[model samples]
Target: MANYRLVSFKTCPWVQRAAIVLREKKIPFEFQHIEPDNRPDWFRAISPHNKVPVLRIDDRISLFESASIAEYLDETHAPRLHPEDPVERAINRAWIEYMPTFVDLTSGHAYVDSEAEFEKAVAAVPGAFAKLETAIEARKGGPFFNGARYSLVDAAYAPFLQRHLFLERIRKIGQIDRFPRVKAWAVALSERPSTHSFPPAEFEAMYRASVKKRNKWISQFVTEKAAAE
Candidate 1:
């Protein structure tokens, strides 16, 4: 049996982050891909919340949040993903929190047909990116997030950053050129061998399929509502 098993979906940024950390640590495990629309009963059994990135270790199941999982793995595994220093580890944690806040408030809700909402999200990006840019500049030592070493912070943020860059092309939201440090950091991180393991083309196909399905559902809903009226 595989020492670890991860139930996850490729398109979910959270799951992607966990996968990245596992790869970076050179941890061997089994990956079971779950579909967003149709989550399996076994996954729900492992994770009561039915969330992806549920990791099974020696018959112990864990769930609810990717950051925690990454931290857990870092603590357990051979290579440390966070700084040894307590203060630096806290700083790394802060960055992890920061990435998700921006992602949830801005990027996550940004994808819609509304031009106004999209513009609002676009505006928020600069401020969010600015904060990260300053953080990276002030820290100043890394090709990664926290100096020369790759930390849990980088693992936490890499997947979201990758999606941000990918969406720029698919959504036509413009490159992240304004945030030079972040852009550079993302490029370096994406080139890592682990990143290649999470196939981008497959994720994109899944996303497109989701869009089509959602549109069809909406159309049917509207038609049924009109007929009832």
Candidate 2:
């Protein structure tokens, strides 16, 4: 087995996806948290894009971008996470590709300056998730995106769902409830042991700190008591 090191920012969603994939595959890896603002020369040397979620394989090869890192992990590890059927796998890949857009759509609420703008952003959320709901409804079984079996699609979206849950706690957008399938899928992903690859205390602390630092409309919703959880 190659020595894997995941270079990431503690609160990065993209980084979370790669971390989740590693945990799901039961792969042991070293987690290296780097400050995006003060990246070291070594990280810059390995990351052409200067992005988080760089998987340094055996300190020889480096893979940047969450999707590519995930694909590599699935292709190399046992118990492949993607579907066997080529068409089905392609379909899943399409949905996986859509996650970044979905995340952007839902993330707008935090940056908006006013409640009205926040509401508009929140209203736009369901439309993005509705598309996902249709895709999930088309699939066969329970909880996961691909019915009974867990796939890379689930891993791709898990970070978004985890953050969505936190967003809801920060302020109830209620958009998630509008799509039953998406809501259920988020719940199911939350229950997966691999869903939280980062330490809860550390993740929550950094997440809340990031929100507060933004000092935007949503920051008002987060309270000092947030840590009590």
Candidate 3:
């Protein structure tokens, strides 16, 4: 067995995606957390993108990009997470790439300060999810993006959905509620053991802290929750 080390940031969703795939494959690996703002020279040397979720194999070769890391793991390990059919696999890969569009819309919760801006941010979310809703509806299946089976696309979106749930707790975004199928897909992904790949309490604390640090409109809700605890 090859020794594996995953380079990560505590609150990074992308890093969590790689961790989810690792855990799903039952791969034993070491997790190394680093400060994203002050990266070490060694990390910089290995990561051309200077991003977290760098997977190092046997302390020699390093792979960057969460999607690439997840694909590599799925390819090398047993019980493939991707579709066997070439066309289906290609389609799945395309949806995985589409995740950033959805993620970017939800991420506005932590950045927008004014009520007007936040409202605008919230309004834009449904439009983004509508595309996903259409895709889910087209699938004409239940629970996951690819009907009954969970695929790399599910892994790709799990982090974003997890974070969205956290944000919803702070304030009811409810954008996801409009798309029932998409909402069900999110729930199915959440129930999977891999979706909880990171320590939930730890992730919640770190995520809340990051949002608090932003001191935006949403931060007030997070602050209130902290005081209540």
- The numbered model that scores best in TM-score is 2
The whole-model C-alpha lDDT of candidate 1 against the native structure comes to 0.70
* Candidate 2: stretches off by over 4 Å: 226-229
Using all chains and alpha carbons, the TM-scores for the candidates as numbered come to 0.84, 0.94, 0.93
Models ranked on TM-score: 2, 3, 1
Give the poorly placed runs of model 3, Cα more than 4 Å off.
Answer: 224-229
Q: Backbone clashes in each candidate structure, one number apiece?
A: 2, 0, 0
Give the alpha-carbon lDDT of every model: 0.70, 0.86, 0.84
Residue 183 C-alpha lDDT in model 1: 85
Q: Model 1: per-residue lDDT, tens digit, 5-94?
A: 878785677787888888888888877787888987777777867787788886675655787788788888868878888898888888
lDDT-best of 1 and 3: 3
Query: Top lDDT: which candidate number?
Result: 2
Comparing 1 and 2 on TM-score, the stronger one: 2
Give the lDDT ranking, best first.
2, 3, 1
